[model samples]
Target: MKPTDTQRLLRRMFDAAIAAAQPALCVPPLLPPAPKGRLVVIGAGKASAAMARAVEQHWPGPLSGLVVTRYGYAVPCERIEIVEAAHPVPDAAGEKAAARLLQTVQGLGADDLVLCLISGGGSALLPLPLPGLTLADLQALNQALLASGASITEMNCVRRHLSAIQGGRLAAACHPARVLNLLLSDVPGDDPIDIASGPTVPDPTTCADALAILRRYRIRVPPTALAWLESGDGESLKPGDLRLPLIDTHFIATPQRALEAAAAVARQAGLHAHILGDAIEGEARDVAKALAGIALQTVRRGQPFQSPCVLLSGGETTVTLKGQGRGGRNVEFLLALAVALRGEPGIHALAGDTDGVDGQEEIAGALIGPDTLDRAWALGLNPRERLDANDGHGFFEALGDAVITGPTLTNVNDFRAIVIDGPPTEAP
Candidate 1:
């Protein structure tokens, strides 16, 4: 029942990835110079509260603000108020906090600064729907999008249009004041505007583009929402908008950084690190199958990489919810990889969301050892059935392999590592 060396290495890599994105570590060194006037901070996302605390610790000028984080991800701050809200689904609490954030920035002088801490899940954490769209409408649409398997960019594009505060609208609220948006990117490509729907940055995606995405995904929208989009009433702040010129943005942390940190861990452990890509994206199961194939090749033929190497990948993956089991993209990908690998020797893998929560669950993801499939079968759990049912969480939970690092107060989407050792040597 002792843990293997590969398992230990996998957990270490995950921890390194999470540590690389922590707000305290990544946000402080990049803090902007204080403004002449009061610095008013505001933000929304899983990391916003932590990011706010980082700003308060480093900032010298007088400051006050509010930030919204997903419930249970909050950190204490003296000057900045932290509000917890639902994520991946907006709640009334998020709406209220978002409103307060906007109000806190009003009437600032040209010399004043608005510090906006933004990260993943902000689109749901700052749901200030435009006129005529009820919270209920947004809630329903968000549920659809979560189930629709839409890419993060597509989902945020739609969100930017529907929100009153997102998509550079928050920057517009600051008007004459200088706006500094410190963003921790969780989306592929690290697009600042897509992080938390870009509340303090210009939105390049149009309402027309939003409409196109919705139609492509066949996500049902209320007639009011449809009409609003068609009329451009929900349009976000565009690139040419005058208010955006004063706004500045910095990507304080990103998925690529996280992956690189993990890669460093692998090299320290004497394993050659092969980073496939930092922005890999696709259906979770499909991506899992592809990675498994590559891992097999490395083990069987030593083609892409030699033995004793670890493959690292980071980025967000999607899951099209159809079955009735608890699901998360990370677990889904891990489970599918387990199925594809089928107890393949000398290969162990781990996948988890860097935020410490995956697919609306507190569980980050799960680990897959070479014996993963055999042990699951012995425990009466069918990996194939679980994957088919989209029960990735359930499947891994039954095996007690779920990685449960709750509320790391950061978000970088997915972190995956596959270690391939040489063929098992004969045992005495």
Candidate 2:
């Protein structure tokens, strides 16, 4: 039996995310031989636990350590302990887990090896606030940032300043030990330090950058945090830090790889695939509007590409919240796209997070047809109101259009595709 379009699109998204997180797909076989002393595994992110499991499976030497992931993202790992924590927001579990991870890496000698499995969500998963800043302070700042529509880079620049373990501080803690960081990139540009806030990599971002981001967002951070920023006391490890002499980092999976996978799938499905970009960023709604414009151009002019082609993109998009309803960035993007399309014919689209959860919601994302708004109206739902409420989950759920794939155990950020049919047709 042939798969439905939704099924095909979902499978493509899942395949893309997994492909971007796989170890063999990422880890080089010719890594310098393991050090003579103890080998410790440490990490934090939605994909960290799975990455740790992959490492345990392939490593020929004895390894022991711990990694923290969002609740329910854990995979069974005998050698490495997996701790589940909160994401997009920090909790005491995340705090405790981060503390343990810090203690685990300390005091290692030069002969020892520290394998760091870093990925998206680590920024929240490893929320170890610096001196004079409380977890509550960080939490409030995180909430403000989430609703500020700030780009991840901007948000992470702020986080790096507030964190004790991020911006290469974690790697620095294991000074004199050989640190090998294996990452699954979810941030645009694949800057190693930006992925999971660069817990295991040096950060070039400065206190001034963080302060500027806060000012741009008009977020009122704790006075202590501001003072720390002014003091420049939180500066992260720099490129010339002698402690990083033996450190090595590799990006195992990235949005680029995920987009390529989706492109391959689109070709197999008899469609020409044009990848707009793998690192697109900005507000979800604005991005949708821009994407809709391109999609319309493709249909009307056939200048960008011919019909029977799919526009594919992958990256993490941000949603600046103006409403009290629950919504993920992917859903916000889809809702915005639907409104812009204005019930245009022959277009179908899906936008979702690769990790099977969008923002803080359980649903991965949603799908929309040309009739998305019409379907909602027929059901007496107000698409615009829901969009305003940031209620993508509620809106899609009411239409039975929400995509739910629980804990895929990987993360590469967002996956979006727009499929334009051969031509416009009468209303079905």
Candidate 3:
């Protein structure tokens, strides 16, 4: 297969994966029965606005509420208010919106319904710090967590304890209302408590767990925050908390489902699709090295699988920030893979975030082929230096290999497709 054809196929698979997790397609079918009394919607995440829009279109009864999403991700909603805020970090807008969300569900009775739309990035989008903590404290903690290379679960454990709205606090505030949680999973394993740090779900982790994670990663916090956690003053609502209302949680979209959608696209193209795993997680470059070894084995020996096949995987990966260059885990993985492959022919790959934003850049991720390193060398670029500097975005953008998809309005973590084309004589 030609390189252009390979790139086209990879992109089609990614688009399919993204489309499969869209709120319009996944949210409506799984929506709970309409409440007998008031239906109040509340949410926070990159996809929460879209999820809220989906609810407005499908519900038969009148509903009104609030949802906070990352800036540039809001969709048109009539009844449910959509507020845009900063992501991967919290801001004043998110703080205010979170405060209002708590107020919106207050004083409700057993007949009322609180529909909570939660998804990836919600942890940062709903930054209602404890009374003694300030937004700046949350901001600093988030930055430290991002750079700590801790797993998503561990990071969210800390976030849940420090926040007033997350960790089932919002559900508790609903009192006698019935709370229905619609979650779009972006974390590995699709754990409900890990989604947006479980704003509407009970948290099994304690303040001690949060403190342990902080200490393990050497993340520092204010003296007041430390005293709160040590004193258990910031403890989250545990399971069986009487204040929490009757709650039901459902996953509308998950990384596994997205990977399956991409697999279907590959099969339709007459290519063999092998799903490696749906919840693979590790350091970015390390994961690339492991995947590159598998790809090489398939390309050289065809041992575990035959040629003319595609290897697909989905999950969130982390990057330890040691350099100053712009980096996203997806792009970092591609760059590392390119270095490991060392321009091996008949191998092409693409890795991207379904949300269309990888790290802080608007670019989704990147694409790599056998000639990726060659093209870089031709332009006097050093792949090793770029990788060392954590400049995957800069390196890929310079080679015109960066994949840009603006505001996909969904989040299913990362999508990776490794395409290995067989020799002409052995082609299927």
Overall local distance difference test of candidate 3 = 0.92
**C-alpha positional error of residue 309 in candidate 2 after TM-score superposition, expressed in Å:** 0.4
Q: Who is ahead in lDDT, 2 or 3? A: 3
lDDT of 2 by residue, 281-348 (tens): 98898899999998887776675678878888887788888898896999999998999999877788
Residue 50 of model 2, lDDT score: 79
Give lDDT per model, in order: 0.89, 0.85, 0.92
Model 1 gets an lDDT of: 0.89
Among residues 3 or more apart in sequence or in different chains, the pairs in candidate 2 whose N, CA or C atoms overlap within 3 Å are none
Q: Which RMSD values do the candidates have, in order?
A: 2.2, 2.8, 1.9
How many angstroms is residue 153 displaced in model 1 relative to the true structure, after the best TM-score fit?
A: 0.6
Model 2 TM-score is: 0.95
- lDDT rank, highest first? 3, 1, 2
Candidate 3's C-alpha runs over 4 A off are: 1-3, 423-428
> Which candidate ranks first by lDDT, i.e. highest?
3
How do all models score by TM-score?
A: 0.97, 0.95, 0.97
**Predicted structure 2: clash tally:** 0
